[model samples]
Target: MKAVLFDMDGVLVDSEEYWVALEEEEVLPEAVGEGVVDDEEITGMNYREIHGYLDDHYGEHLDIGREQFETYYEDAADDLYSERVELIEGFEKLADDLRDRGVRTAVVSSSPLDWIGIVVDRFEIGEHFDALVSGDEIEGPSKPEPEVYEIAAAEVGVDPADCVAVEDSENGVEAANRAGMTSVGYRTEINQGMDLSKADHVAEGPEELRGLLLELTS
Candidate 1:
């Protein structure tokens, strides 16, 4: 592979649990009342798009505006990144190894730019990436649509066919496949129940992910 593209939330940082908790326990309940939204419904979507999805499905019952609903996530992100988030084991070393081998590396995510910045800064891993692309940067729909990964491949100066994408969500795997890259589905305790069978490969944990990357780029 000429490049390696990574998804941020569950693949790079152990933040999926925090997001799931925020969505299930706080955001959904306050916006559309309890028992309406599920964690799976918004797992791989941009925070703003989560509000849009909820509005589309349950707008009639929603008493709050989208902007207001987003703050819950934004505030939670601040706390998560600063105090709670942890990097996936071996990710830093894997990123460094990829860069040493002259393979382009990047972070491609459904998250907003500022949120991506928080994670990168908190973990001090930004220098490992040749590019960082956020779903919010594109005008089109995010993951499960392939636009973000397509843009990411272009920005990193690699053909989609020559890149390998590591993802932890079904939507993320779908997006990478649609972009024509080799997709590696990552399974973690946080996403154990999600289907990732569409990916070209599957890695059960961080060490497995490292082994996959090493083999792919070797």
Candidate 2:
């Protein structure tokens, strides 16, 4: 593989749970009625796009305006990334291993850039990545559309087909596949029920993910 594009929330850090919880407990209830918004529906989607999705689907039932709905998520991200999130097991070593092998690595996520900064800075893993790409940076659709991964591959000076994308959600896997990258589906307890069948390969946990990356790049 010429490069590795990683999804930040579940692949880099164990923060998908925090996001699901926040949506379950706070955002969805006010915007889409209680228990109506499924975590899977928003997983791998950009926050801004998520608001648009909810507004489009559940606008009449919403208790809050689009702006207010988005604000709740933005405020939650500050707390979630700063205090609640932790790096995924073996991520530090995995990143180091990729760097030692001269492989280009990057954080390609549906999250905003500032939220990505929080995780990389907190974990001190910024130096490991050649590029840090955000969904919001792209002009059109984000994950599940391949634009972000396509942009990520370009930013790192690699062909999309020569890169491997590690993702935890179905939308992310679909995006990588659409980008012509080899998609490695990362399964974790937090994302057990989410579909990832589109991936070229599947890794059950962080160690397995490491092994998959090593085997691919070897």
Candidate 3:
């Protein structure tokens, strides 16, 4: 692989757990007014896109306007990414190894640039990446669509076929694969239940992810 694209939430940080928790506690019950939401249907979707999805799927049950629903997520994200979640174990070393090998790297996420910025700054991992592509910057649909991954490949000047994308959600894996990149499924304790069967490979933890990435990029 000439380049590696990483999904930020569950792949780079432990933020997904927090997101799921918050959604269960507030967004689902208070905003969308749903008692049960299948996260697989939403994870890897941009926060804005998520609003459209929820409003469409649960429109009849919605208790808030689009702006208010977004506020619910934005406020929670500020606390989650900045003050709560930690970078995944071994990511600094993994990123450095990829860069040292002349493999270009980028973070491809459904998050906005500002949210990504907080995690980058908090972990000081921004320098390890050549590009940071967020869904907000793309005009196309979010994950489960190939646009974001395609954009990431372009941003790093690599063809999609030559990039290995590591993602923690089903939507992310599908997006990478559809973009013509090799998709590697990453798993954490909180997202171990996710079905990443569509990926080219599955890495169970940070160490496995590091090893798989090194092997692929080698």
- Whole-model lDDT per candidate: 0.88, 0.89, 0.88
Question: How high is each candidate's TM-score?
Answer: 0.94, 0.96, 0.96
lDDT by residue for model 3 over 105-179, one digit each (tens)? 999999999999999998888899999999888897899899999999999999999999999999999999999
In candidate 3, which residue ranges exceed 4 Å CA deviation? none
lDDT of 1 by residue, 1-218 (tens): 99999999998888998888877787778888989766776778888787778778988878788779888887788888878989899887888888888999999999988888988898888899989999778898888889999999999999999999999998899899999999999999999888889999999998989998999999
Report the Cα lDDT for residue 36, model 3: 54
Cα displacement (Å) at residue 203, model 3: 0.4
TM-score quality measure for candidate 2: 0.96
Q: Model 1: runs farther than 4 Å from truth?
A: none
Best by lDDT: 2
Which candidate, 1 or 2, has the higher lDDT? 2
lDDT of 2 by residue, 1-218 (tens): 97999999888888899888888888888777887778798898998888888778877876777788779878888889989888889887988888888899999998999999998888788888999999768999888899999999999999998899999999999999999999999999999999888899999998899999998988
